[model samples]
Target: MCSHYDPVLNAQKLKQHFGVDDLPPGLKPSLWPTYVGPFLRKHEHADVGDEAVPFKELMVGSFGLIPHWAKDTKIARQTYNARSETVHEKPAFRDSWRLNRHCIIPAEAIFEPDWRSGKGVATRIVRTDGKPMGIAGIWTGWKNPANGEILRSFSMLTVNADDHSFMRNFHKPDDEKRMVVILHEDEYDGWLNSTAEDARHYLRQYPADGMRVAVHD
Candidate 1:
């Protein structure tokens, strides 16, 4: 599961690659569980009126998902990554998954642990082409009972990568390999508008050939 990543912070890249204008403020340089970051969702008015209205809108939110039933924001620590196989049944993720609150998490790179060199080593993975990654995810809102404030959050969806040529190299050898689902540029709109059942089609692993990895010193 992806627990750490660098959120895309370049304004021009965000605008040109994701078609998102007006960057949200307070996005952290890097994201971990509970960290705030930007996510792209289908614009509420996408199909309502003017054709000039962008198809997507950018919003800032916690990197981890916070369900409506969550008692507090601390749940974010454990809800950062939703397993694709059981997201529909997991309490922390089911609501957003069922409601089709699909979103795209734009990331500059994702970090994973490589244990091949006798110990765990942090490794960074990014697209070989140097473009930002549009990771598939789900978003939701939670109302704080104590303060009556609405907290928005999201979680990246992950799939089994046991057979992936590149991704299978990370993590402990004994553990099941996994990788986040990254959408192609052309599939963004289709994924955001897809129904719950149809969203499953976009949950597959990204091709290993499209990514490049570097070990951190």
Candidate 2:
């Protein structure tokens, strides 16, 4: 699971990189479960009446996904990650995937556990060239029936990485290795607007050579 990540860019840089006029302010430098961070998603026509339709915008939303049927937010703890293979069928993510509620989650680095030391060690993974990653994500808006408040949240999609040269090093030894789906610079917009079947083509593993890691005690 990608429990932690860092979005190191400021408001101005995000706007320039994502090619948008307005940027949200709550781009948390470091994000963990329940933390709010910047994400890019195309707004739905009904969600933004009278506003430009199909326009992508930056919004600050919570990290974990809260399914529409969820009775409370506690489900987010486990929904932060949705496996790519089953995302379209998973109970928590299926609705969003079917509705084409895709999002691009920007991050400078992701935290993982390096188990090479015969014990788990915290590790940070980043691009060797130091570019921010546009990770593929799916989002949903759950309205609280009690108070009528809408909660928007998202989950990063992960693919099997047991055979990956670099990504296989993270996670527990007994657990299946996995890595987030890092979208290429040009693929960001396409992912946000693509249909569920079309988006499947973008769920491949990133080249391991482009990534480097740092271990922490």
Runs of candidate 1 with Cα error greater than 4 angstroms are: 215-217
* Tens-digit lDDT track of model 2 for 1-217: 7899997466565666676545555466788888887788986653566655646777767799999899988888888889999998988999999999999888878999899888888788988877778899999888988899998999999999999999998888999999999998899888988999999999989999988984431
CA error at residue 153 for candidate 2, angstroms: 0.4
Native-referenced Cα lDDT, model 2: 0.85
lDDT of 2 at 166: 93
Steric clash pairs (candidate 2): none
Q: What is the TM-score of each predicted model, taking all chains together?
A: 0.96, 0.90
Model 2: worst 10 consecutive residues (lDDT sum): 45-54
Best candidate (score: lDDT) = 1
Q: In angstroms, give how far residue 200 of model 1 lies from its true place.
A: 1.2
Model 2 misplaced regions, further than 4 Å: 45-54, 214-217
Give the distance in Å from residue 45's predicted Cα in candidate 2 to where it truly belongs.
Answer: 4.3
Residue-pair clashes per candidate, as listed?
0, 0
